[model samples]
Target: MLVYVVATALAVLFTYISVVYDKTLKDSLQKSRYVYLKPRIDVWQKLTLYVLRVASVLPLVLVAGFRYKVGTDWGNYLRSFRSVTHGKDGHYGEKGYRFIQKFVAFFTSNYIWLFLLCAIIFAGFYFVGIYKMSINPPLSVALIVATSIYFSFLNGMRQGLAQAILFFSLRYVFKRDWKRFLIFVLLASSFHKSSLVFLIVYILYGFKIDIKRIIFYIVIFGMVGLAGGQLVKYVVMKTKYAHYYMSAFADGGFEWLWFFISTAILVVMCCYYENGQKSELKGQFNVLLWMQMISVIFCLISATVPESNRIVWMFNIGQILSLPILISLEKDKRWRLVLLVLILGFYMLATYIAIRGGSHRVLPYRMSFGGE
Candidate 1:
């Protein structure tokens, strides 16, 4: 627990310093040819940013990759790695991840290499995405730590890698480049079938939302929720690739009150931002708002169908960017600081509950390096 706290603090501090230096460079270069040619940073700033980036990424990689008997899926992943090493079939149609495991197993029998490679991929894409899309990079990194989405890197390895890759699609999304966006979506889906649902984000990117559409979606989601596990059961039964997850219906006790509260907060934030700001990032906010709404619907459905939360998680990942973007929308310095404090406070509370919560399966951290 102390280790986790220290790692989290160091991540926030390094990322904050990096963002501060980056913003200074951007601000100073506004009128220079360097701004138009490239984001020219002085040698010192470049070195500082690179060091900070490493500081921000290394601990997460170490913790996620070296952990032993940690995370709910640790045993499952270990079995799969061993199976692949023995030339046996593993993974349920997630060929991309299976191939990675097999390739790593060829070089080393230990599954630690698999975890390390996945962590590198996850961190590379995740950090680059946050750097590219966020108006406030430090806040975005803090949110990831606070929300404990980092746990997904340690547990849901396949989905974590897929989600990180999908994060890159946001660039194509805002540019309206359908071909590029679809390519990334398809690639992500190859890692985790659930990621296929994120393809809808391309369509929702530029969609104009109004009261009527909101009400219509709410009604549709309500109807699906009322169907309980039946709807999800039917879908799973029909989809050959997902049939393995059919047993998830046996325990239909997904609680989504937290998601509901989060959705309400997002709705209010979006409304406030739309009424006030005319920033370039408004389009990005719109895309995030629509995704959040979709996430809310999935969360509602998950209340009845436990397996639906996988889909909810895919969409909820947007909050890493959305929440920070929302906070950045505040123009007044005082109000912005206030909002930042409130957000950090709420996230800290959420992180505490997550670590203590049964479903998160993230407590009592154990590492292979420690002889666990």
Candidate 2:
């Protein structure tokens, strides 16, 4: 528990420092005396910014990379890594993940290399994703920790990689780069077939949410949810995800916690609605709104078709990303601070519950190579 606490604190602190550095550098460079030296100063600023950003992400990468028997699937992943290293057909994970396992095994039979590489991939994509798409990157990074999404990366390695890739692909979605977006979706799907669901975002990205459309989506998805279990069973049976049908996930149940959290964020956004907001801000908010709505739909489906909850994660980025945008839109400074504290406090409490729950088995953090 102390391990997680310290890692979270360090990640948040370093991220805050990076944010401060950016602001301070920008302000300092705007002076008339710095005009002649702008080129040199700009180069230095870019280098320093890169370093700070890397520092902000290093704690998370190190903690995740150095773990041993930590994540719930630690043993399972090790078996698969060893199988690949021995020139056997890896049977545990997605083909893309297996391919990477084989590629790594070609160089070293040690499984720690695979773990470290996966940690780097997860951290790199997450940091770069939030950095590119988030208005408040620090808040977004903190939310990732406080909401226990970071732990998910430690457990669901392949799905985590897919999610991170899809998260980064959002920038292309906002830019309306169809070719790039499709490419990324295909890339993510190679790691986890569930990520293919993200392709719908491309088509629905332009939706301007209104009461009528909201009601329509609710009705449509609600009906789908009613038949969710059977529907998912049939669809997954046709794909590599067929095994989920026999797993604990097939017993459908609503994710009340996720429902509440996602709905709360959407409601908060609606409460703080501003018609006079900047076009760029509005655009970003609108895209995230659709992402949030997708989360809501899957949450509804998961109630009766629990396996669909996996799909929920692919779209849940909006739940965290939307909060900072709302905060930025707030006119009252004190109220803004209040909102920030409430959201952060709520998620921090969530982190305690999630860690204590032990679903991911990430506590009692132990290092690899048989160290405590």
Candidate 3:
């Protein structure tokens, strides 16, 4: 637990430095009259950004990659890796992850290679996604880490990978490049079949959400929740998850914390929209609002369908990015600080609850490189 706390704090601190230094470098370049010095400035900027990016994620990658008998599914993933090495068919996870396992096993039977590869992909996409799309990358990184998305990666590697890909693919959604967006969604689903739910994101991309539409969507999805169990069960029975149908049909407890957090983020977004800060990114903001609302709806559905919360994870990227952007949108300095402290405090408290409550068994951190 101390390890996680220290690592996360260091990650956020490095990210803060990276964001601030990047701006400083840009300003320095603009103020310089030396034409020949522009090339040097650009090189320095790139090098610093790259170095800090690696620094921010390095601790997490090392912790996750070297972990042994950690994470609830640690043994399960090990067995799967060994299974792939032995030329047996996959008995767990989706085809894409299994294919990668087989490809790695062809070169070496060591499960460390597979685990390390997954750790890199998970951390890489998470950092790159925020760096590319967020208006305030430091706050974005802090919020995402605090929300437990980063820690959950250790427990659900396949779903974590899928969610990472989907989060990074938000670039295409913001750009309105449907071809690229669809391609990435398909890739994510190949890692975890549950990721197919993200296809609905492209449909929601064009919507301009207002209070009335928000209420309408809530009511409609609320009705879906009333029968979500049977609907989800019927769908699971037709898929590879059929064996888990009984469990899926059982009621999954409501994720009240996430629901409240997302609702708070959505309210902030609505305030930003009402204030009429109509930048070119406003369209993207609208898309994120729709996604955040959908995240809340999935949380509601989880009251009946046990598996629907994974869909909430898919939409979490929206809330993660939206809050930081809203912070950037706030023109008043005092209000901005207040909003930042409130949101950060909320998410950090969530992290505290998760760690103390032992969600995912991510306590008493352990590490090992040797195999069974």
Q: Encode model 1's per-residue lDDT on 1-372: one tens digit a residue.
A: 677778777777877777887777778777576557654677987788788887877777777878888777878888898888788888633988888887898888888888888888887787888888877776777676676677765667888889888888888998899999989888888898888888888888667767447647866876767575576667766776364455644465654544745666566665665542476777777788877777777776665665666776677778888877777677789987887787678767766876778555767887885222
* CA RMSD of each candidate after superposition: 3.2, 2.4, 2.3
Model 1 lDDT, residue 27, Cα: 81
Q: Over the stretch 64-155, how does candidate 3's per-residue lDDT look in tens digits?
A: 88888777777898898888778897677888898888878889987888888898998888889888888877777776668788777888
Model 2 TM-score on a 0 to 1 scale: 0.91
Q: Candidate 1, overall lDDT?
A: 0.75
Q: What do the candidate models score in CA lDDT, each in turn?
A: 0.75, 0.78, 0.80
Candidate 3: where are CA atoms >4 Å away?
A: 33-45, 248-251
lDDT of 2 by residue, 1-372 (tens): 788778777887888888888878767767644676543356777898899898889888888888998888888888988888778988877788988898888998888888888888988988888887788888898887776778887888988889888888888888889999899888888889888888888777676677446658767977876766576667768986677777876676677877777778766766655541354677767777777777787788785664676777778765556778888887799999999998888777766876787857888788875212
- Model 2: weakest 10-residue lDDT segment is 271-280
What would you estimate as the lDDT of candidate 2?
0.78
Q: Give, for candidate 1, the lowest lDDT window spanning 10 residues.
A: 241-250
Query: What lDDT would candidate 3 get against the real structure?
Result: 0.80
